[model samples]
Structure formats: C-alpha cells, structure tokens
Target: MLSEESSTSKENIGLTSSETSTKPRSNLMASVELTGFADNGAGTISATLGNKANKDIAKTVITQERTTDGVWTCKIDGSQAAKYKEKFNPTGCVKK
Candidate 1:
C-alpha cells in the first residue's frame, strides 16, 4: 500500500514525462511565389524553404511589342528564361 502523498507525486512525474514525450515536431517544405512588380518594370517575388527561411528571388523584366493585327510578341532575357526552365524542369529543354 502506498501513501497518499507518494501516489500523488508519482502521478505528477508520470504526467510530466508523458507530456514531454508527446511534444510535437515541426515539418517544413519549400515553395515559391510571385509577389509583385518592381520600379523598373520587373516582377518582384519571394521564395521560402522553412520557418523563418525566406529570400528575395529575383525581379524579371517583361517586354511586349505589337507584331501584327490583334497579335503581340513577348520577350524575356535568355538568362532568365534558362533559369526558369531549369527550376521547373531539370531534364534539359527540347525543341521540336
């Protein structure tokens, strides 16, 4: 037979240990998004990996010109194009 005080102390210790063992852990993921535009006609955006992990990715410039009736041509920097392609699809670009 156990005393009342001893039983209470044991229950408290068990509760504390159970709470500590059941503590939740954090899981993180990587993501990217386009935020907005910049001063020099460029797109501003952000990229994040985990909690408190963020970065100002880049500002891409968008250019458009009227080519024909109801038609327009758009262009982007070659370097920027390559970077985006590589980011989305690592397996080289194919031309048909």
Candidate 2:
C-alpha cells in the first residue's frame, strides 16, 4: 500500500514530467517594415522576430532621399543582406 505522501510525490513527479515533455519547440520567424517617418527626414521602421531571443540578432538601416519635386522617398537597406540562423534544441542543431 502506498502512503498518502508517497502518492502525492508520485503524482507531482508525473505532472512535471508530462509538462516538460509536452512543451512545444519554438517556431520563430522575423520581418521588418518601414512604419513611419522621423524628424530628420529619415524613415522610422522596426524589425521584430517571433522569439524575443532573436530580437537583436540582426542590424538594420533605413535610407531616405529627396527628389527634385521636394518629395521624400524612403527605403529599407541592408534588409536583403540580413541573414538568419535557426537553432534547434536538444541536439543544438543550427540551420542557415
């Protein structure tokens, strides 16, 4: 016969094991777009990732130019050159 304390400990251990086993791996992706304009005539944009751990994984820049008609055109530079290295857990696999 199992004591009440032993039974409770077994239940706790089982719950913890199940919780850890059921945790899904992270599926992360990131994208950036120009969202607004700055006071210095520069475009203000933001880059974000699905995982907070990847927020600072890359550097970005915005470029703006004035046309002959006094119109400003904004674009995202360094975007195409950005690279992402995806990481997988347990085995610590890295995919580029």
Candidate 3:
C-alpha cells in the first residue's frame, strides 16, 4: 500500500498510483568497441554508439559515407605502403 507520504517520495516522482503496479528497476551502462565487440548480446540493450567519427584521418584519398556503419576504410599512403605492407588491417595499424 502506498501512503500519501510514500507516494510523493522523490524516488517515485513523475509516476502515478496506477504506475505503482509495476515497481521501478535499475539499468546498467552498455558499451561497444571494434568488430569483435562481445559476440554475445546483452539481455537489456542500452548501447550508445557514437554517430560521429571524431577522427582526422587523411591520406592519398579519404572516402567516407554516413550510410556505411562500423566499417571505417582509409587509403594507404603510397610512400608508407612498404612499411605497412604486412600490417594488421587495410588502414595500417598504429600502436599507441
């Protein structure tokens, strides 16, 4: 039973007595990185994928499209090709 005092509690703010039928629940933060982002999905999906790529990637030719999802491609510099011939990915790997 919800007493008048309990009904107005800050925790239940913006909720109504009818809404009280369903108790409130907590949510955990979700994150993802790279193609190998957890192979298994979460029970409660709450991922925050950044829509913008805040990167300054430039080379012989820089091609990008909004429709392209998760796939980031970059042209290899002609001069640097030899140094990155056996690199990991097509864009060449840079260890920080």
TM-score: which candidate is best? 2
Model 2 Cα lDDT, one tens digit per residue, 1-96: 111232322222231123324221323324333322323333333333343334434333333444444576444333333453333111422221
Shift in Å, residue 18, candidate 3: 54
- TM values, all candidates: 0.22, 0.24, 0.15
Output the lDDT of residue 3, model 1. 17
Task: Say which prediction, candidate 2 or candidate 3, comes out ahead on TM-score.
Answer: 2
lDDT of 3 at 37: 21
Per-residue lDDT tens digits of candidate 3, residues 1-96?
112233322233322233343221312111221122223321111122122322222111122211124443333322322233224334442221
- Candidate 3 has a TM-score of 0.15
| Higher-scoring candidate on TM-score, 1 or 3 | 1
Clashes of each: 0, 0, 0
Instruction: Mark the 10 consecutive residues where model 3 has the least summed lDDT.
Output: 58-67
User: How accurate locally is residue 19 in candidate 1, as Cα lDDT from 0 to 100?
Assistant: 32
**What lDDT would candidate 1 get against the real structure?**
0.28
In order, the Cα lDDT scores of the candidates are 0.28, 0.33, 0.25
Clashing residue pairs, candidate 1? none
The 10-residue segment of model 2 with minimum total lDDT is: 87-96
